[model samples]
Target: MIPEPIPEPRDAESEAQPLDAYSQAVSAVARELTPRVASLRVRQRGREGSGSAVTFTADGFLLTNAHVVGGARGGQAAFADGTTTSFNVVGTDPLSDLAVVRADGDTPGPVTLGDSDGLVVGQLVVAVGNPLGLAGSVTAGVVSALGRSLPTRSGNAVRVIEDVIQTDAALNPGNSGGALADSRGHVVGINTAVAGIGLGLAVPINSTSRRIIGALMRDGRVRRAFLGLVANPVPVPAALRERLGQRDALRVADVVPASPAARAGLRRGDLVLTAGGVPVSQAQSLQRLMFAEAIGRPLQITVLRNGAMVDVIAEPTELDAEHA
Candidate 1:
């Protein structure tokens, strides 16, 4: 047999290079956050169920989905370190699908909250939680969409969780109430729903949600003011933009009969430019202004009607089960 040609000297430069950037980022996040996630076993109607929760405070305050604990007051939280603690529901806001629970013992350090406002589509995100009762589970994906609305109802109160984060991470039923963290391990959203294969939804952790969390911790409920107007985002005309300084506005799609908007003389096709001196571009902007403090208060609404800017004073009514 012919002698094999002398193998060329192995070149180190030609060696396969490892691309571990993605892995490193995800692993770092998982390492930091896995400890703060908890597997919750809740008892409801004589049946035991499991869900995930994130410890948002060092003293054992946890944030979870209201639907997960649905009508239950107490549960057990198991952490990654095999420690378990009894937790009691502090409050629940079905409209936001968020609930706060206080655990009996110490917990891992609270996660740092990140601003969801800065999130962009295609940003890498990591989901950490207990899924299908598998505690400390982790998944990685990109934010596929943003500014989504999740409609919810509690009794007769119809509400929408606006600006929800949509990701491509695989979410299971137990993933509800878990953390949807960024590459830096900051919690940007709370995992809420599994829409379809590779599709997940989270409640964005922004100013509005921060307020909701504070309310749940303090008052055990969130008080909201209702303006009975169906609106859609629309661009302000060039002429209107120069006067209002806003490029986008909410166009009144339908004014509820005898409701606040109707009472205030708001009509169909009215382009809402501002509410209470704040720019009204999307529904969430108005929702942010409709806190407990705004209830029963005269809200100055500026709308473009027939090419003229008109101010309408509408007193918001407290949103209740009987009238949402």
Candidate 2:
């Protein structure tokens, strides 16, 4: 066999790079992602805040938080080129806090989607969007934590956001549903909830969002099942371990009537052990499963009660705009 060719050495043809390369890179990414953003000037039936949504799909499709575009009887989406177009709400999923809109004009393609499950804490991340009426804004920060739970503003007590990626990424109001991109310009998370303080919150585009996106592109609504229950993490405490028969699970506060849980016989004082065979109650794990689950697919749920194990089948229903 011919001797293997010697591997080429590292080329020193590198162009001049400045120390402010970090700032430069941020600007470059902002430019690349911003042309895709269109301001969501929603004209709601009721009083709703005006915000922005970024473009993710070509063919005039855009992505935004459900609350941002929800309940809008009429609206206009404004682009950076001073061109504004009328848009219609295509889909909304409060569980995932995402909505898609289709405008009457050409839409730029969204950033490349990436694997959110591979994100690491302390990794550098950047948020690009219009914040507080400021356009073409970008902020940088590290992944503060993963697997976070925040209550819904609806207070329906039926919904609790889990697996939220916490970042000090300096996000602001208009950033909702904008692209939280990785250094390589791949989309990782959808900027969703913010503390309304200095803290920023985003939902990782786990396999779940991907499916939702595909479905929304195909249909105007996402048909997924839901468990009519108010849930909170069952934190492992020294006292609860003995009194509650702890199992690193989610404690059920309330369950919906005539829901999959009620049909499958889920009751109070029960702890959810797993969702469709994956561990439940860990904010991240629960989120990952819900995100990946197909709407209407019966879920095999493992639960613990009085130190005994039980199972239930729960199917999610379609998420509709009128539900808001």
* TM-scores, all models, native as reference: 0.81, 0.73
Backbone clashes counted, model 2: 9
Looking at model 1, residue 318 earns an lDDT score of 81
- Model 2, 1-324: lDDT tens per residue? 999999777655554466487777677777787777767778665565666777766677788777787667457777666667888888777777778888887666666777777888887778877643456767888788776655564444345555677888887777887778777667688788777566788877777677777777678666654555445566644655666455567777666665556777888767877788776656555554543344678888887788677877777554433322
**Model 2 pairs in collision:** 208-291, 224-295, 224-316, 224-317, 225-315, 225-316, 225-317, 226-316, 228-256
lDDT of 1: 0.85
Go through the candidates in order and give each one's C-alpha lDDT.
Answer: 0.85, 0.70
Number of the top-ranking candidate, with TM-score as the measure: 1
**RMSD value for candidate 1:** 4.7
Give the Cα error of residue 11 in candidate 2, in Å.
Answer: 32
